[model samples]
Target: MNERRTPAVAPAALDDIDRALINALQGDFPLAQRPFADVGARLGLAEEEVLARLQRLLDARVLTRFGPMFQIERIGGAFCLAAMSVPDATFDRVAAQVNDFPEVAHNYRRGHALNMWFVLATERPDGIADCARRIETATGLPVFLFPKEREYFVEMKLEA
Candidate 1:
């Protein structure tokens, strides 16, 4: 496996309000007609301010993703972790090809024999093998699937 070195990125600076907002959002988000307004009211901010701050954080790359996580298995879907040993020269291209699949939840690089790892969330359990085969055909590399044998829940919250 080829190790790719990436430049270090400086951590984004956060103000007190941004820190508060990040902490609050980690828990249950209010279900309301104007959710931002509700959040703002709790933090002594206006709706527009809350929206603006969140947008700014995202634009600055301070936040990579903000969204809901659903249990695909409960809905008759499947999530599989797949990996491939991509040649160094074609790693980026293969990553792009893999990401083109709509079922891919996220893809990341690792420093191992199987360096390219990604998660595939399909609408059906059998779709896992089908998607892996499609990826193998597309990338000309074998995809290794590791389906979960058991599930565990971990609550993770980071202070901004």
Candidate 2:
């Protein structure tokens, strides 16, 4: 049976170098076949060292899965920014119900009227709407879906 996998580790505190790596990597990544090798070269680290450190960061849950953001709509795939106005009393239960879907890539608590937010990725363009309906039916909370209206290539950086 195919099962959903969740991060297992209690994320470790990052040192200054790790912080630098994370912040720097948020910008442009090379499109070459050996992109990590190119990234390592620019960062003054060996390719093997870069891979090891990246693995450590991932294992520690400091970084989620790394991948390119494609224009999914153009390719007939889909992604949605979804949220639920979950009550405080049943927040965990609602979150678990929503996360049970393979389509929900990740979800986190937020400080807002819509308290539980997540990103959903699906293979088909209609999958986001379907997942939202299923989650609403299962959790008894209205699922709000925000499909991307436009794609922007911005150079903004978030310093860690």
Candidate 3:
């Protein structure tokens, strides 16, 4: 859980096709036996070419992940968005401590007072609160839990 992620930037070799592919596929991914093939057809790309390009993107850390967004509660899981006000001097150390938990999906350093934000996912409803307390104990910082009471479907599209 302490493992750091490779820098999340598209490689310099990233091209138009990659950008277009990211944008096109971000919104709606077709559910099929060969979903990549279906997407390839729309983009005028061979199935293999599409798969290769996507793999390259991932290998280069351009895409952290590509998959379905699951509703955790339906699958006997739970998650929460949490943030903390980490001091500038201890940000890196504090972040590392926070990320040490297996339940932390990912953490981001943002340009705000509450600069460190992360998602915690677990297999049970109470796990979210437990994680917050654990993180607070580990980092000596109060965790602001922002759990969603109502679900919102926002179709976000990014052009690379």
Top lDDT hit? 1
Residues 20-138 of candidate 1 have per-residue lDDT tens digits of: 99998887899889999999999999999999999988767677668788898999999999889988888888887888898985577888888988899999999999999998999
Clash list (residue pairs), candidate 2: none
Ranking by lDDT: 1, 3, 2
lDDT of 3 at 1: 19
User: How well does model 1 score by local distance difference test?
Assistant: 0.85
What is the clash count for each candidate, in the order shown? 0, 0, 0
Considering lDDT, which of the candidate structures 1 and 2 is the better prediction for this target?
1
Question: Candidate 1, residue 102: CA error in Å?
Answer: 2.0
In model 2, which runs have C-alpha deviations exceeding 4 angstroms? 1-11, 148-152
User: lDDT per prediction?
Assistant: 0.85, 0.79, 0.84
Candidate 3 per-residue lDDT, tens place, 7-116, comes to 33434587889988898778678888999999999999999999999998878767778888888999999989999998989888888788789998668888788888
Cα error, candidate 3, residue 81 (Å): 1.5
Deviation in Å, model 3, residue 76 alpha carbon: 3.0
Deviation from native of the Cα of residue 115 in model 2, angstroms: 1.6
lDDT of 2 by residue, 43-142 (tens): 7888898888889988776677766767777788888899889888887777778888989976888778988888888889788898899999999889
Q: Would you list the rank order by TM-score, best first?
A: 1, 3, 2
